[model samples]
Target: MTTAATTETSAITETAALQDRLDFYWSGRAAEYHAHQVSGARAAIDRELWASVFATALDGCGREGSGALDILDVGTGSGYLASLLADAGHRVTGVDHSPGMVSAAQAAHPDLRVLIGDAHAPGILASSLDAVVNRYVLWTLPDPVAAARAWRTLLRPGGTVVAVDATWFPHGVDPAMKVPSADGEDAFVRTYDPATLGALPLGTAASMEDFAEVFLVAGFTDVIVKPLPQVAELDLRFGVAPGHESRPHFVVTARCP
Candidate 1:
């Protein structure tokens, strides 16, 4: 193979390897992750903020006038966002790369449709969805720009893509800094090498501006980026660990024109 071809092949191999690790990580923590979502006052407040964000994004997609818009929740771990959207009178289909996550989400929301699929390539029909929404998922992607382009293809003309993420570790921090377990249901401490964990493409985004650019380049228009006010306030009032308080979590919304 030529030098350029060799580089491309190496890149593909790395992405696949990283994806496998991610699936294993999430699948192993599926139960604990779901437990953390529903436990404590902070989690409740966060969920409310997510609901408001999704409602606004759906409204932007003209869902208020239209009835029950079809929304795809990519990387719908444990179906937290899917439940909220379905409760708000929208048709939701969730897709996750981890089978364990899919099963957990389905068990949590039996009525909701949840499938095991890659977020980078959701395999949904073109122009079949009014919106694609994900929370804390973008940073985990190996190629978020490519993922954004794939999601754009799934939306209708007026549809929108709403992503909720944060610059969790701007300074290239180690993943071991995270709390061992939030809910205490599963206390599995990650033993991955700090360097390897840090090198993962996830959480490398310096700012929301980088994400906005990705969306714009993917053919989205009228991109909006803003912090979740309630979350920020709660984070201050009931502060988390020392380092986590400063992480700026924000919502990014871009419309397909």
Candidate 2:
């Protein structure tokens, strides 16, 4: 085989391996993930903030005499966001790549539907959704721009896409140090190594402008970026470590036009 073919094959193998590792990691921590999200005063505050962000985005989608809005929560580990939206009268479906995570979500919210699927390629019909919401998912994705483009295709005209994330680890931090886990499993988890963590295309390093640009390139309009004040306050009050306190978290919203 040619060198190009060999490189392509290697890349595919690496991608698959990385995905497998992530699947196993999340699967093992499903219960811990849900518990962290729903427990504690800080968790309650974060949920309210997330709900407000998503609720506002969904409301902007407009009913147009239609029934409830159809919302898809990509990477909906444990269905936290899905349940919140469902309770708010929206038709919610959650998709996760990890089978264990999906099972946990289904068990937690039997009323809500959660499926095992890749967030980057959620196999849903085009233009079938009114909104797609994700929280702390971008960092884990290998190709966020591709995922954003896919999300745009999933929404109908005037539909919205909302992503909530933060820069969990800044540039200077030692990757080996105890960093707050985005998966909600632990207050602090040890990293693999500096090289591995540094090589990751983390959303944490991407600024608000970076996210807005991706959405704009993906055919979205009315992009809005804002910080979650409540979340920032809660972080300061309940931060586990020095750098973890009041980390730069923001909510990005864009409309499919």
Candidate 3:
């Protein structure tokens, strides 16, 4: 896990700058992204899968929606998950530091609420949310622990926080293939520091343990870890597959104790 270290380049590539870049990146590719929302079928299929995950969490706690469940989607790049929850009757608030991404999300999912804000400081009230969800946004942050702790602060008592992100390390697999050039201005997906992304900074490959510990220390409970495996030829070929190199992605779920 990456520690909350300050970067000098923040002036040039701070969260705000990165957010702007991401916003521009997604806005330009929003159509293509929405088109490929699901591997097969309408974009909503991915939405359904996320809905299932969130519903499972809710169901595990034996709580049905009293009204619309108040949910927050942090780093909600395109607001797909928040839109899904909104469709499922959740009063969803999607936050991303990227305004362009938020705009695109709002444009596509007009019914859902989208906010441009930092996950580290969501501006949402602390201890007032029922659940906070982050999808594929973990690797982008410079400080995963502080970010997670910030999310924890937004949850109400017993509120569940679920984070799903790519947990693959860039092993020297097929290193001969040159990295592809992206079509638009937003080309390279920024990677974390070599240490955090490669081996654990202060620990082993089980570095997620460090991430889990951050939340534990901050006040989350019932932490559950799941590794999603990617095993198809296409998954491997895409290079974005959630395996060990891109297939076996891990997720951590915990409750605000």
Candidate 4:
């Protein structure tokens, strides 16, 4: 089992691979994207932006213990994060919509449970989870409010939901960097305006107040929003455009009460 600080270079590289796995439309480009991200230049983008977001979300899950803590990683592409958590002694279940991603994760960590399923489905039931962690998924969902509500239903009273996602596009990169639709219809990407990104479905908007409010409405309490300080190394390397050079996404932790 490896701690955050002790994960090997290969494992870190593996984590980078998983990040590219999130653009569900890019399944064919996985290898290329993975390679583009492994250089030192890209390392900072990951550390400052992505890894920090996961760390913040996991923080709300509390500390590791001898007894196993139950956790679900929604959109658990390649299960690297869940694998790391499990290494630290948590009992983790990872679920993803992509079969390829699920297969990769399960193959990578045979000891952990990886399932092929949609986060929006009833496959996960009410009050059955201790915590739910999602990253880079909110903006992709067509119905963000319903998605949040579903997450709330899956958590037990006092359980935590930790989610992180970017609100802005790459500075010079247009949405075209991503195919408008991957599945023959304009159904894959849910385009959100800046206003929409900050609102209930996509995010709590800019205010920590609004962020907390959504969780409260979803029946959560003690919600906290933490703004991760930018890491220059991360930005220069993995950032798609200049906008990401200055701004990083927010990670929120809210507990179901």
Candidate 5:
């Protein structure tokens, strides 16, 4: 084979290997991650706060209250969002890459439909969903732009895509992004190696516009990024986990058109 072809094959092999490593890391971290997420969303009011955010976004497109919207929750770790949306009377299907996470979500909410699927390459039909939603997903994606563009093909015309995430790693995948788990381990530091960190453009993203422009560039229309004030308010009342204080999240809304 030529030099270029050999290089291409090696790159593909490396990427596949990295994804495998990521899957394992997330799987092993599922127990700790679920506990953390569930704790924050333990209160009914906090769950409702997030529900309202989804409601308003769905309402903007005249989807909410019109009927039961079909929503796809990508990277549905522990099924927290799936349960919330299901309780709100929407038809929700959750997709995660790790079997561990899929199991946690299913075990927590037996009735919910949670499948093992990649966040970037979901095995879903085209233009068959009313919305594609994710929480804390974009920051680590190797190709977020490609993922956003793929999501556009999954939503029906006028459907909305909502992403809830914050700049957790303002300093990229360095020691600064490390936070000890309940057991005093930082799984993120282990999972995000040099290649992983290099691939994630949003890891060091410093502004909200950085998140907003992604959807805009992906061919989505009416992209808007706004502070999740409700989340901040709840954080103040409930208290956040260590190292998360003063770190506010934002919601990005982009219309599939």
Candidate 6:
């Protein structure tokens, strides 16, 4: 009825539409994306670094004392990180919004139970998880702040959240082009819709502090951040996915309070 109400409603509708488009886009690219992720995971140096991070996270979250964790891997494209967590002796359940990605993950690791689910609203029971983890998924969220809040609710009290992401679009987004293989270079708009970039508040965050603040606002405590120059090194040695630029990634962890 009011002008302000109409504007707010329109913005919400538009953002939801944009998120649907993003899911479709990523689903279509699952094969290409999985190929890229496998290359990165196959790098021994990077694998070692991530393994160490997860090991430290398990200890930091008191998993070592409590026993293996019931970890939910949100936005688990291709179950790459899920496998790593399984290797760490955790009971891992993964959720992703993209069917194609779910299929890819299942195909790659038939043992992993990855379901079609949204990161912002995973539908997991409240306080049922010992940990929530993701990699490179936060930046793509239409609402990272809300997603962080939801993740906090999914974890039990004293349970921890571990996520790794980077400044992938610090200078703002460029059109993501489709590729044939891991190295295809044809230019086309597929990764993000420029008009919707504004809706993603953390999509182009300049620093790790921007990400850390989300959990802090969500009532998480004991937040810790560590820079991953090792990721940059992996990119330097093995090269990044086509259309992606290399930057230092960071692992941020926080405990539910």
Query: Tens-digit lDDT track for model 2 on 44-132?
Result: 76777777777766665744724578889999999999999898898999999988889889999999989988877998899999989
Those runs of model 1 whose alpha carbons end farther than 4 Å from true positions after fitting are: 1-7, 63-65, 175-178, 181-202, 241-246
Say which candidate scores most in lDDT: 5
Model 5: lDDT equals 0.82
lDDT of 5 by residue, 16-66 (tens): 787787777777777777777667544678677788888887775534537
Model 2: lDDT of residue 69: 89
Candidate 4 error regions (>4 Å):
1-26, 29-67, 170-213, 231-233, 237-247
State residue 1's C-alpha deviation in candidate 6, in Å.
3.3
- TM-score of candidate 4 relative to the true fold: 0.64
Residue 185 in model 6: lDDT = 41
The lowest-lDDT stretch of 10 consecutive residues in candidate 3 is 195-204
lDDT of 1 by residue, 1-257 (tens): 47998999988898788677667767777887788778876777777777877787667575455678899999999999999999989889999998778989999999999999888899899989999999988877767788899999998887889998887656655544554333232222242344444644555568878777779877889999987666667778877643244577788999988
lDDT of 6: 0.81
lDDT of 3 by residue, 1-257 (tens): 44345344443355455455545555555555554554553334445556776677655431454556678899887778887778777788999876657777888888888888887789998877888887767655656677788888888778888777643443423323323223332233332234323322222233456555656766788987766552233345444412224444556789887
Error of 4 at 137 (Å): 1.0
Candidate 6: Cα lDDT at 245? 75
TM-score for all models, in order of appearance: 0.87, 0.86, 0.73, 0.64, 0.89, 0.89
After aligning candidate 6 to the native by TM-score, how far in Å is the CA of 198 from where it should be? 1.2
Tens-place lDDT per residue, model 4, 1-257, is: 87676667765575334333434543442333333444456543463455545554655453331245677888777676677667667778888776666766776678988897766663776778778887666554544555667888887776788876554343222433333233322222332334323332444233434444556676677788776555434455445532123446567788877
Residue range with the least summed lDDT across 10 consecutive positions in model 1: 180-189
Q: Which order, best to worst by lDDT?
A: 5, 6, 1, 2, 3, 4
